[model samples]
Target: MARLLSELISFLEALPEPRIVMDADYRIVAANAAYMREFGAAGGLVGRRCYEVSHHFSVPCDQAGESCPLKQSLESGTPQRVLHLHHTPRGEEHVAVDTTPIRNEAGEITYFVETMSVVRHSSSRPAAQGLVGRAPAFIRMLEKVMRVAHSGAAVLLLGETGTGKELVAHAIHEASSREKGPFVPVDCAGMTETLFESELFGYEKGAFTGAAHRKLGLVEAAAGGTLFLDEIGELPLSQQVKLLRLLETGTYRRVGGLDCLSADFRLVCATHQDLRAMVAEGRFRRDLYFRINSFPIHTPALHERKEDIPLLASSLLERVDRRPGRRLSPAALNWLQGRRFDGNIRELRNLIERASLLADGDTVDLVHVQEMAEDLPLDLSASAGDAAGEFRVSGVQPLAELELAYLRWARRQQPDDTGELARALGVSPRTLYRKLRAAGA
Candidate 1:
């Protein structure tokens, strides 16, 4: 009988859920491996009160006064079950608990055997593998992107800067039948007006000054693949005309060459700018706008989809942990959710990376995040205040006026290029020129 009891105890201990044996006084006699893993220290639990092991409290179990399963099992000398929200040193966990009284030879309750199984929170939809959120707007956008991925038509992604426009473009390309093809990205804003033509259409040897060797442009290089044109609104008007021509006939010639080459690649363009508005204002070519906007997808800004912030923060923390042991604390996550991420995902990533570097321990806390926020050269709060002040003073100025104010503020804060602001505000150089024209700046 003793051997059988020992084997039974071992079997219960090996169960996935936590198990424990306690005396009538709630003193823990034995705890299983799962309990040890969760409580962090099982050895010290023996002969300690159940409250000490589970709740880290010195008093008796709070539920014991309300017909608790453990108390009931001991009093009635019968098995009992209950669902509990258990608080431990780590965190709160939902559990299904069962307690059975062990009887002595004379039929008196000797000990209570407790078994617990964690209750997992059920999710309504299958979680997105690499993405986040299940909000209607987010789901609708994702569905649209999936639907458009099978078509061969050119896709134009529209969104604010840091809204993950490039990510959506890449998703469309990867989900399409052209998944096997290379995804080539070209930053249209990075090139100068003079360098744009040679870079996009390739240049022949000695095509222009310092053109030493024949080189293939991004268009030709992405043949049989997908060419992602990022910040396409930044393209010069002259380059827009050439790009439109290629879209119309898929034919282009190297700079200074008569031979025309045809590119058999998929085209995906992304821009934070409003091409339709630009076209209406005579800044962007109407024909070019129609050509590239065949199928359009808009990525939501971080603020617009605040519901996904928690998941995004958790994923970012996991990514941060990949480098080292750095992780986000609950306080840090709460702080992040409350923050105004003007730069959106890009800002969040930068903040996380900075916090990881500055964190003294594995867990990133609120102080670390606050320090990182303070370190940001651009005072986002002050910028927001200035914008509000301008709005109040001007009684709703034109977007151009607001943009100029924002640009001036951003330029004053950071010595780097104003390209980020230009993109985020969704204004082309020509449109910005018109803003300057109107403002007389």
Candidate 2:
């Protein structure tokens, strides 16, 4: 039944911007060249279910309470147009679709002809458009990030992990004068002191037992660019001293070499840890901390601006499922706002991804969200019990310390479940084991 319109599909080529013909069951009978190119559906189009191809949905559009222009035109025997947000290869876009019905001699609708065109709105949300929020806190943070990006000052991004510190770091690098240069990022959380030095400062051939060839360190690799050191708070004091010398002297020598080499990279370091507490406890060097803390910026946690939940969830959902019309129903947005995401955006992303798997429909509703919430890690209920005391509360703990403590507890809980532990921690199992080894677990 779908391929019945295959003969007329080729005629839509001139309409442009992804035109398609669909049958009564929402199956794509034929698609134009624009549709194929834009949607990456060049080879196969005939007989494929339209909802699956366009929305990643298991059902029809009207079922989601969305105005299905196709259905409307079919029933009324007239033109139908509806504006909807579409996920394109470029990004999330507002598209105006014009749907026309093809009818038989008896005036019964036989097929739907859809023409899509991208729309530009005057009252569009700018800061919230791609970044996905108009909340004051998020807006202020974006302003600070933009300001910090233009300067050459060392940036100390203070945010809980998964609050998007690295994203801001990349934004800063992109906005800087050194954007054309390399933007190298290194995870400092899981390296030994020796490994840290070698990785950051490179190594001469025969520098160590396994040193078969000369290699450039991350610093050298990032010369004339930005070197982003992630999880800076976890860097050991021994390695911190070396990093301090490089920052102070602007030079570092290769492992097993005397000649000092210069690296002209801008420094951008991030940590969720409170460095002042570490400095007071003599765990972090005051001099190094002062040097790197030149321009401090904080990324707000998800719970900080709950008002932006709708924007963020919609943006994240579109990102997870890029099919043009996939989305979360209003109930799903409310569901997200009502919950406690101690893990912040990272947790929300995981939940959304999981819910997408569980949801058989185009829209993820309250039921789908609640069903997926059962598996979320770090139960607040458990946190209220003795496990709360187990997680601890001192005057103030470094972020790294808190994370390590949680990892230990989670490890105990899932000793044989590496995947579960990784999912719980928002990291891969390889990263989980690497962190354990680095922390001497």
Candidate 3:
């Protein structure tokens, strides 16, 4: 088997496009010559994990927060496709990826084939490369972000604490024209007035008691780029006036400095708090709120997009565990679909992380998931994955009687749909009806 798998290395190396074969453990088992030219050193790829060479991350692409087509294909037992922004030698480039699963003789997925094509269009770059969502609200939000990103507008992100606002902020920056510029993020929460001034505007030498030399502030660091002020509602009234001055004038003076310097940077702000209410309560300055709120983008909370949970969970698990063949069983998925993820994406990551550790083998089952759930305070139940046996009889019955009994059981679960019952038993609806009628069931 080892020699057989090694033989694939030569065949893969001949492909025109960059292609790699990852084993169930996500180790790069083989890479073609194009792949070597594209992203490798031409040797020692066989032992390295795919994420290390491609993403420079310690974890899998899904866990490192990129939607992974490799993992997606493994689970579906079919080809999967995704658009990604990969860090190439030249810079970030848009790549369309197609993944196909390779199954062993016993029909178990053992490896994946990943082929990547560079996408040329700018508008089609997925706003957030790894952020997974299919819900209507999520799609709407993504569309809005994509549209707003290209323009040099001040974007205000609003969402619950765990709703992934920073990811949205970065997406807007990535999709915008200034993607090459540095994206400097500032957390405004609990920053003292002195700290705010020093951080946003650099202090000249001898300007302050501890200032031994001139320091470059975040605003200057983000020149010709983006300056993200997260939790802007936390800015004190005194600091708000100073930020307003900078935004309005497009200039700022260093802390205790003599000259005014230009701050050529795009502004983006985000917070879970209601800035409008803060303004109404006289906590947040009205003018600053208006300056940053030119284009408001709201990230929907997890519950609002329940339909996306399945993909989200799959993506998160793939991110957490990269053991090539690890999978969330159909039963486990049925259980996860019914969860109310209060912590949103972050909380889901925790659940999967813990449950993955509890689960053994490639398939994470109902028992493993339920065990994790019982230990946590999360509200969940076993009703989804639990299966009540089809056999109501105490002893073995004839094959005919067994078929009729199982068909009857399938009917109770599917209820009144001949096609659904037939699907459950892997039989044609006509055959299902004929058997039931023959058995007087």
lDDT of 2 by residue, 217-255 (tens): 999999889999999899999999999999999999999
Q: How much does candidate 2 score in TM-score?
A: 0.57
Per-residue lDDT value at 118 in model 3: 56
Per-residue lDDT for 85-183 in model 1, tens only?
Answer: 466544555445789887766777777888875433211122222444444455555656766777899889888898777777777777778888888
Runs with alpha carbons beyond 4 Å of true place in candidate 2: 1-130, 322-324, 375-441
Which stretches of model 1 miss by more than 4 angstroms? 1-131, 320-322, 375-441
Report the candidate with higher lDDT, 1 versus 3.
Answer: 3
Please give the TM-score that candidate 1 achieves against the real structure. Answer: 0.56
The alpha-carbon lDDT assigned to residue 120 of candidate 1 equals: 36
- The clash tally of candidate 3 reads 6
Angstrom error of the Cα, residue 356, model 2: value is 0.6
The best candidate in terms of TM-score: 2
In terms of TM-score, which candidate is stronger, 1 or 2? 2
Estimate the lDDT of model 1.
0.69
